[model samples]
Target: MRRPLSLFLSAVALMMTATALAAPHPVPLSELFPNSGHARSAIIINKVLERYHYRKVKLDNAFARQVLAKYLAALDPNRAFFLARDVERFENGARRLEENLRRGELDAAFDIFRVYRMRVDERVAGALKLLDGQFDFGRAESYAFPPSSASSPSTARWAQDSAELDELWRKRVKNDFLTLRLAGKADPEIRERLQKRYEGLARRIHQFNGDDVFQTFMNAYTETLEPHTSYMSPSTSENFDISMKLSLEGIGAVLRGDNEYTVVQSTVPGGPARESGQIHAGDQIVGVAQGLDGALEDVVGWRLEDVVDKIRGPKGSVVRLQLLSKSSGSTAQTREVSLVRNEIKLEDQAAKTFVVDPLANAPGLKIGVIEIPAFYRDFAAEGAGNQDFRSTTRDVRKLVEQLVAQGVDGILIDLRANGGGSLAEATSLAGLFIDTGPVVQVKDNFGKVEVETDTDPGVAYNGPLAVLVDRDSASASEIFAAAIQDYGRGLIIGEPTFGKGTVQTLIDLNRYVPGEHNDLGRLRLTMAEFFRISGGSTQLRGVEPDIRFPGADYLTNHGERSLDNALPWTQIKPADYKRVGQVSVDRLAQQSAERIAQDVGFRMLTERSKLMRDAEAQTQVSLRETERREEDKRRERAFKELQNRFLQARGITPVDEDADQIDEDALDAQRKAIARIEVDEAARILADRILMERERQPRAVMKD
Candidate 1:
């Protein structure tokens, strides 16, 4: 939503930015202590949370230990770099971490970082030396990626001694070489790249400034209270402003640093990345290249800000990304996408409409699909007194009118990946559905609760409405969907939403400190929690659909529940609103389930989803060339068979198995065809609802 709180907090993760690389000056680890104003900032942050934060948590010794664990995890996530003894050493002094941080005593924390840095140097030197040694590809060994229990690396990369750590790095280096070899790079090229990659890793570690360290420590502290709360550096805080103003010129995707990889967290609505339809959330960017002809830069280990810099350019310039999608199970192959960089146009992102005509454009009943990429509103335009200002409510109202004029029987508001914006827009949008009622409830840190009601007495295309949401739908999206479900106005038919109900306000650190204070970064602190009008808070348990689809569990552990230290789900006094009880959800869901079980496209999607889960479960891969090749061939065969099945079912000609490249138009056509399968199913679901609801009032039925 808008910065309702003095916290700007719609987007998820804003990573810390590294300093401009002007020839790396060696920063001695000993000198990396808390800066002059950190003590005051810490004390002030404590006071703010105590006064305004929704969750009243203590910063005691137990909290101190959690902070230490989080700090170490942020620095060395894979349990790599530091030995068990090193961790134990820090664990011994973990209680002091919080006390020292509050008192601005950062010497112990800096010492822990020093040990981490020294281990990195050791590993880098050893890995570089191992590159020159002859490697046996046929060796029956595998590397455990992400250090799991899955038969890859033994002991989860946690080492007892330096020798064990050396073996871990050796396997890491081997996995690196194997990945390149599979990608078809030559031995010499692989060697050069690996050397550069390893050396650059060490250099980047040395490049960490005091601000970066402080930012990491502070985030560990804030997030310990709640996952949404965070500390942003000055450079990082700039992105928050850019995102709120929609002034970014890039691929229009929000990225987060996941270990060594830059992951696509979410794409901005109407941005090149979202519009491209190829890139998706959970896709990992391994390489970034400038333009169509630029040589690919391996960005697997690069800093997040550096990778972002590479992805962004002047509007209309081409940027190429090599993505390893989460859906490409077993065959962890990367796909390249070329997106033209541009600003997020409000008009482009406005609610759009299409008609799903089962009768192929004949004079028959149709289903109007309104795809909302995000719940957006042009605050600037509205502030200028522009009656025609862009907003979800206004655009959707117009779309509904068009649908009504076109004689559609029902409407499905497609909110599949809408990651929520604009609280006012959501409340007003809900107003468009019902004549008048309470839509949502907001409860602050204090016990005060306020109800957001739809005051307008207007209904737009309210006949047999349904909302289609996926796991990515959050905040305002959840608010609208919950309202629809609560009022018995529509069927919420997809997966449960992303539970991000707590509201955060951005506070400038300098504003808290007295004169002569340093440029302390801002804090995006959680101050309020959202409860549905019916009473349940949408903080941890996002709104569950009235009819959860077969593939509702498509994204496992990908919601608010997956976040550590998230606010607990609770209930408050329910708002006094009447339920229409128009939707027979049980009857409609039973009819929909039978049809979905037999539908070819839905069945195929379910099978592919299983394959993806199986692939993701695999943390180990054979190092032997023969076994690796065999496995790749098997995965290729499976993928090819699935593709051919989908194409054959859709009545399209399948391409040859050996075909290297497919044209963009062909790919786009395939995507549209596949998407139509799901959209068509959703229409069928809504049509079933309409037919049942027709008992109250007659409506035309959709024909096959």
Candidate 2:
């Protein structure tokens, strides 16, 4: 059975050739948008970071290794592109990265990126080839989506001539086709759509210029320091300015990349997407199209900026989006929505007040709710000395006065989904409730602590006040809430706030080096941290609510602590502040918790949240059509049952089992109704507090 020596040698030679072919070919790096001031820019950035960054870490050899790993991870996070050998090659320059950075030499970074580009090209080509073969729907196969528990292949595993990688890609394409097929797409349509999606990926890679690579590399560097600190390229700086102005003509949704899908982060209150009520946070946008008659373009693997460009258009124009419902059991369920673009008016973000009737048992008390979307201020107008400039503090103060005039018994400041804005506004707003005291503490990079105090001695309206905050309330929101809570001015209700307390100062790179015509991007450097009056740093542990609600799935991944590089929580000396309110949060929390335990809607929400968490934890998805369909049915049943329970609790008409074709308006109404239920619960909690306060007062004092 001995084989000939020449035959064995021939087989070994063929295997070696296959391995070499599988290894990615390095693409030559070119200097595009050559900046003569790169070395100067790097030196200035390093100097500023070392001098002013809050962390105050040295950029030594150890730090260089971390940066090297971070850069590689940034480029190939999923381990689907660059091979292990490429990573090893890049590691050879790791120790020298710090020295190179000090000298403004980015050759190693550029070399790594060039290899990444080549790997992307190779992978895309391989993926496209997989689409040519027929997939077996009956086969028991699965695709492990990202954040998978499985580790990446080693260099030796990758160098092997086995068909494992090809099989993995084949399964991926098959999964894509299966999802579309379940969504009612025919075979031909599915193939064509997937082909376009893959082609778009290659096209986007091919279109990457030097500025894009530099931006990516710089972001990797800054983000390694902290999550919030970032470097914005010149073009991105302009976009940031536009966003701050809130005048961009688009659907008004903040989109972020999650794996291969573009997910809706949040919708502007007055934007087309929010008004239409068709889009929601956590929904995945798979395809986009132009006006009414445009063909649907698959945007699964498109760049985030490219997708954003397609979504934005002139005011009054229509743009269509095809979305995969996050709530749906299967990704196959989709809906198409068309929205008319419009400007996000300042009025939409302004503070507004409304009256809510007392709880079912307590009928006489009327509660006022003031919704503050963001801690906004017209800085330009204010700087120009416009006495009537709009700001969150001024607007909220007026709303409070208006509510008091309306004879409301209590007031609730709703800060749900209020991502914090101006810190000045937050302090001024807190002053409206408190007479005069320290609002927040700021600790700079050099260990210098400064107390931000409210100089105003007049309280606007301090009657039975309550501040409601959810996980989205952050930074300035936390500042205001903490001040109010520390002074015992209001009850903090709802979920814990988002834990982002660091202060970022923008450094214009061009200013550091004069006579440099190149457009050097700005650096958003975290130079300070915020602390509550109670001395606790709101870095990772946000302000905990007095009364907690059912857990939300979004909280699993959307908190400051979820970020790997987020700053840690610490404490300092507590600021001096006197308690002004007599309300007992502990008793109120107990009452609310009891009520929630008995509430069927809350119970249903809790169960649904658990199901969502379980679903998200699942990494592998079946490719078999029958199994997928069964799973889909199970998920639909669970969702509908939860919906029915919520409706039953509210005494609203439950949706019929066979009534699957609900109109868009009906769906919007349902969503609003669900939201109203939560608001109603919050109002009831305030009502309970009002009644308790009434019971505590002396009869003579009450009559006065």
Residues 547-629, candidate 2: write the lDDT tens digits: 77876433575557656578899988988877787557787778777888787777666776666566656678999999998
Q: Worst 10-residue stretch by lDDT in candidate 1? A: 10-19
The lDDT per prediction is: 0.76, 0.74
Measured against the true structure, the TM-scores of the candidates, in listed sequence, are: 0.92, 0.89
Candidate 2 ranges with C-alpha deviation above 4 Å: 1-37, 148-162, 238-246, 329-332, 383-385, 552-554, 648-668, 698-704
The C-alpha stretches of model 1 lying farther than 4 A from their native spots are 2-24, 147-157, 238-246, 329-331, 359-364, 654-661, 695-704
TM-score of 2: 0.89
* Clash statistics: count for each candidate: 4, 0
